[model samples]
Target: MRVAALDDDVDQLELTKYTLQAVGHDCHVFQDGDSLLRELRRESYDLLVLDWSLPDMSGPEIVQWIRDNLTERIPILFLTNRREERDIVEGLSCGADDFMIKPMRVGELVARVQALLRRVYAEPLPTEQVWGRYKFMPIGRRLEIDGKAVSLTQKEFDIALFLFRNKGRLLSRRHLLESLWGSSNPPGTELMSRSLDTHISRIRSVLNLRPENGYRLSAVYGQGYRLESIGNEDYEADAQLAQSQA
Candidate 1:
């Protein structure tokens, strides 16, 4: 999980970073709420670990900002010294999913994080998924075919996942570029569009995606590209017929 942690205390922030990283989470720490909020605007996070008292803003205020602005579902966990019943209620009312008093126990903290993630995000998808001879581990960004690992660059993996998730849909060059490169070409400057074709070609070669292998990645004339599943007999017959006519 990608987590953003906010605490004014330097020592506490470091400890939180170490503890969360120990549990296989990528944690970024901030000394003030403003810095954390700035990072939040640019990147998406799965969870937020907040301190009630901060130099700039209170934890509840940060929570409110997140709830108001961010589109992604992010669970907030408050790690603070406030221990009164009213304090807990206020934190919960402000949209924090869980609250823990300071002097936190690492074990309990980790457990609460896991519980909140499971409850809010619904298990976060399995680490590995198998489709016939292909195996994908999105968390590790790894792919394997028939037990042999295939190396992929970061953008290649991102593109492959995007295509696989949207298989059977015609993904336009604009959509692919925006999805992978974060932006599409401006008016009259479609030169960068060819980059998508290159990536698609590389992905098809690496994955051995073809009609014979139960997968086909094909261009759609003036439309775009489609990744089709040809595993069924009807689709196989159609593919054979198309080949014969060509």
Candidate 2:
């Protein structure tokens, strides 16, 4: 999972990042509201931890901006010094899913975040899940297209399953790498980058991911990858992109 933390205090930001990352989440930290907002525009995050006060904007203001501008209901937690009843009410009313007072307790933060995520995204994958023309048997690590089996390496299967499960979400390279290699491993190293690209290429070809197949796995330059499901209308609209790089 990917989490974004916004706090002006350097120590708090580091603590938030470290604590979240320690628990297998890819954490992105920002010291100001503007920077965080800018990132929210380009990338997608599973959750957000925000301080109530900042030099430029209030946490509620940022929450309002997210609720108004973004289509996804990304869970948000308030981590701040404010502990008044009115403050908590305001935070929740403005669209925050959870509220926590700082000096933040690491255990409580993690528990609250995990609980929020579990509640929001609770749908379980079936043993044999069918998605459009593709069927995935996760336990056996097998994939079938139109009732025909397709062979894939273990790594390739992992990557392909991840992309299929998260279709339409813009997954950052760091998030994808962390999913495969764990948070302890460094992302974007030359070797890791090559390996990631290779696996993606293999999966793209093996899956026959194209508009004709009702799916397109696209590589967003300088960001990451997104597997999009397209209809016939979109197929024609994106014909030129079919020949482009993945």
Q: TM-score of each candidate?
A: 0.58, 0.81
Residues 1-246, model 2: lDDT tens digits: 788999999998999898988888888889899999998877778899999999999999999999999866899999999999999999999999999998989999989989988977645486877788898898989999999999999889889988887788878777787777765358556688789999999899989998888998999888789999989999976776765744
Name the candidate that leads on lDDT: 2
User: What would the per-residue lDDT of candidate 1 be over residues 114-189, giving only the tens digit for each residue?
Assistant: 8987886534246876777788888889999999999998888888877776667566565566556653234443
The segments of candidate 2 whose C-alpha lies over 4 angstroms from its true place after superposition are: 41-43, 68-73, 122-126, 184-188, 236-246
RMSD value for candidate 1: 10.5
* RMSD to native, candidate 2: 3.8
Best by TM-score: 2
Candidate 1 lDDT trough over 10 residues, lowest sum: 182-191
Q: Compute the lDDT of residue 79 as modeled in candidate 2.
A: 97
For model 2, give the 10-residue run with minimal summed lDDT.
181-190
Show pairs that collide, candidate 1: none
